[model samples]
Target chain A: MKVAILGMGSVGKGVASVLSSKDLGVMVTGVADSRSGLIDPDGINIGALLATKRSTGLCGSAGITAMDVVRGAPYDILIEVTPTDAVSGEPALTHIRTALTMGRHVVTSNKGPIVHALHALRSLAASKGTSIRYEATVAGAIPIMHTLADGLAGNEVLALYGVLNGTCNYILTRMAAEGLTYEQALLEAREMGYAEADPTYDVKGIDAAIKLVILANTIWGTSSCLKDVEVRGIDLVTLDALQLAEDQGCTIRLIAEADPSNRILRVSPRILRSRHPLVTEGTLNAITLVTDLAGEITLMGKGAGSVETASAIIGDLLAIRSRYGRCD
Target chain B: MKLEMRDAPGQLVAALKPISDLGGNIIAVIHQRDPGSRSEVLGVQIVLDLPQDRLSDLTDLIRSQGVNILRVNEERLLCTRAVIMIGHLIHTDLGGTVDAIDRTGFAEVTGLTIRMPAIDQRSSARFTIRSVNREHMEDAIAILRTVAREKGLLMIEPMGVSQ
Candidate 1:
């Protein structure tokens, strides 16, 4: 399958590296970063592309933009790994819409488009005989979406509980394991590159809430958005609260939960037992899917990383290829 | 076929005689004897390989023997492949990986064998997967490849053969 990747950031570079390193029967025909774009119908040289990005902080030559890649690039799959803007769901949403409407399958890691316009995008994909897969949006590399759509097929998903935010989980884990205060844990998380500089989304629980919205919509077909989720961050989870929970043989974790049967979706710092499956350490994500047939199935994996998120995008790419081989 | 039979002497043997008498080969028999149950009935799930013409005869013979057949389901797994995966299989949660494939109704990991030399070293497993058909088998393998890539494992798939 021929793929065009937008947003040549960490995850985009990871996808390009995987495509170049592995013989997964996929070729990168076009690539676009924020500033420039490159197009080669035969197939772009990914090694050279990476070198160019490393030396000059850009993907391609002058006068080439993302619009050119989206409108004129020759490819079958459009991989949108751009950073998300939960408020607007812009540029990424437009890119995905263009691809799906043009009869090209879309695999994205951006949560904005999915959280904002899921039904509209899905309708367009269906009408155009294409698909939009975003396994990397929720829990990176967990295959939660695939499990819901295919593995747990023919079963009703009763509820879903997950440690959807890696930054909060890491901070909370440090506080629980090493007895650090919330501020101290947050600083350590930032130092370790687990938490972003602003850290507002990660610490304020908006990230987890957005992920919950995506999961709720994907699994239960609910028209949920960021506003629908009852959000509570770990910013106010004091050390005393952590100690109190520890005294009761539990640790505080930022849990994102969706109960479709009762129409409940929330993300908050909840006290779970120290040895709970969802109580994972470091930058790891865990999700427990409560289904009728499979019972309670928990999947744990690296929540965020270049290659890890790339693994999910590649999985979606392979799924598209397997379902509809090389549309071109 | 799942049947409920009286928990009495010779009840087990009596259930098999009809299948054998109608030229059916018994592949497996899962007999569950619940001692705490109030009813004096045992559940028996028998996997049989037989011609379609003999199914009616077998069911009729079993019914005549007073065995209550609860359910009958066709075995859909007709294609199988054995693959060997190597790396930190245990640390990466091999059970979760296997469950991802097995939970798919069209494919299942029917058998598994693992080998580990040390606690910190790499491990390997030979997995026998059965699917509804060749297409399903391919899909199962594709899922395995995705899991293997995510977990940093090496998967050696079978070539041009089905077990």
Candidate 2:
């Protein structure tokens, strides 16, 4: 199977490496970035890219722009791993839209396009008779998207909520368990590479808001844009605040949530003491999909990283390959 | 100086009574139900435009009422600009991203729009940004770029920095 990676960053490189594994039956044909990329439709040497990346924290190899990758010889799947911006996920949007238009299936870890352009993209995919699978968008490798889209297809998801952002969840979990101040915990998270240097989105709850938009829209056939939802961040979550909430039998978890009935989605630091299955927290993403028949389906696991997320993209690609590869 | 009083039962009224009794005009009261959880605390981003001469008095009065002052600083929200970002937007924490932009004290994500197909893909968003100074908008964009990199997002600045 031919595969192309749209971004050469951590996740993009990770996907390339995973798909290169002989067992996966995938051959990475090209790797692109905002800058140009390297392509070998015959199959690029992903092992070489990984060895270089590990030794030197930079990509010095030939690169291709997203346009080049999409325009090149078709691939069985394209992994759009471009970086995400809070406002416009342009290049990735351009990459996915183009790939869909070109009749190529796309599997991405980019949340920007999924959170902001799901319907249009899906409609485009339908028009092109192509599929866009993004199992790694929410809950990382936990398969939440598949569970809702396939496993629980019979159930009508009433609401879905969880600790969607590992950075915030790590910070909040540290603050809750180790009794660190929000600042102290956030500092630790940054030092450990769990939180970004800027750390604003993780601390404030906007990252979770984006995830909630995706979750809500996926469960319910609605747009659920970020503007429609209410967002409160954890930046205001003082030690005193967390302590007070804990005193009230609650643990503060940075939660991204959507209520299907109200058609509303929200993200913020939530004090959960409901003794529910999803209340436990840490560097884990746990989601509770409330449904009419299944009642509630909860999934929890590592929600980020190259290996975990890449594994998900690979899994989706393989599944798609098994069902649709021979046809195209 | 100003304080953030918990929006508990009679908390605002209680805090206000003290401010009024102490001769404070309660210059501006900004209150809104927290959109995330209704059962949770309501968020109030109030700005008390007190007379400079009476600022200290108002601060002390509000403090005495046990209303915690969340933030006390200069008042400014002029000259806003809009920006758009693309990629893993929500998962990257759009609220935190906006808050980070706002932390510069010059800009904030006043409005946001997002669309997600599923959990594990690039998400797109449009952010209406507002800043105090015109130049601060650039600083806000820089901060957004840094955030976008960490969140595995591809930021689409309105200025259109080509990839």
Candidate 3:
């Protein structure tokens, strides 16, 4: 299978590196980014790209560029890795829509497109007889989407909720354990590289909203628009609130949920007592899904990072390849 | 409406039947699942699908039976605003940061989150608020920024707009 990478950002590079390391039948054909990219239909050198990027942040940035190669050959899969707008999540929406319209299967880690344009994008994919697999969008490395879409495919989901944002969970967990105030926890989190230079989406619950939309759309088979979700950030949590919750044997966690009835979607920080796995610590993500047949099933693991998320995207690619092979 | 009838079985139904008899739809019923459940103050959030002209008569008719309408408030979904807060949002004072914004009457911090790898590491938080108006939203952000500065934390607004 020939794959075309849209951006050579952190996640994109991780995808390319994983594909190259496994020596799977998959080959990267074209790479594109804001900067110029190289395209070799015969298969580009993934190792060479990594080396260039390691030396200088610029080289191997994207697998393809605005400029096309002399041959003008198209790729089977177009991975869109554009930057996400934390607020409206726009341009990413435009890029993914265009790619799907062009009849290319898209796999992205960009939450902007998946969260805001789920209905339109899925409809376009169906119209074009292609799929948009985004395993790495939420829970970074964990296959939360696949768990709901495939593993629990046999059950009717009653309620789906979780601590989807690693950043928030980390801050809360720290506050719970060390009695650190929110500011102290945040300072610690920034030094650890779990947050962006500007960590708006992760902190405000917008990041969790993106993941929630993906789950709601996959489970309900309805368009879960971003605007519909009831969102609450942890910004209101105070040392007193944390102390109060702790005194009651509870801790605060930024949670996201999808409720089909009343068109309700909730994302906020709520106090959880002991025995709730969500109250646990540091960069860990846990999801609880209430189903008619399965009851409540919970899974937890590393929620972010390059290698972990990249591995997820690659795993998704392998699943596609395994099922459809050259046909896909 | 104030209905001072004995809190008995189906008393609500008996009281409500009069409203229906007069072609009045019960917009809300504020009764304790246990009238003794939480001190006789049963609160229900509701909306009526009646024209303003009929509302007065409906209230008058129900009040004649002694059913108390403690307080009637409009039920509407609040507007939400996105805010990016920077500082030791995760470490130094995340809860305080949220509190500063939440305390602002015009806006309430509906969402607050921080990200980082370790507790010892520094991090920032993004805040989402629901307010009645745009000015309320700005005021809330200003409060957060002020608190952040006091804590010796950097305040970054993630909208990508320089503050």
Highest DockQ against the true fold, candidate: 3
* Model 1 vs. true fold: TM: 0.67
lDDT of 1 at A327: 66
lDDT of 2: 0.72
The predicted structure with the larger DockQ, 1 or 3, is: 3
Model 2 spans > 4 angstroms off: A53-63, B1-163
> By TM-score, is 1 or 3 better?
1
- Model 1, A1-328: lDDT tens digits are 7999999999999999999999998888889988889999999999999999999999996689887898898889999999998999989999999988899999999999999999999999999999999999988989988988888899998888899999999998888788897799999998998988899999999999999999988887779888889777877665555655565466678888888765668786665667788889888899998888889899999999999999999999999988986666
lDDT string, candidate 1, B58-112, tens digits: 8888888889989988766868776666678899998898998989988899988
lDDT per residue (tens digit) for residues B59-133 in model 2: 677677777777678655555544445466666666788789767766778877665546875554556677755
Comparing candidate 1 with candidate 3, which one achieves the higher lDDT?
1
Against the true structure, whose lDDT is highest?
1
Alpha-carbon RMSD of each model = 18.1, 17.9, 12.0
After superposition, which runs of candidate 1 have C-alpha atoms over 4 Å from their true positions?
Answer: B1-163
Model 1 steric clash pairs:
none
Off by over 4 Å in 3: A60-73, A86-90, B1-163
Could you tell me how far off, in angstroms, the CA of residue B139 lies in candidate 3 after the best superposition?
A: 31
Q: Is candidate 1 or candidate 2 better by lDDT?
A: 1
> After best superposition, candidate 3 residue A290: deviation in angstroms?
0.7
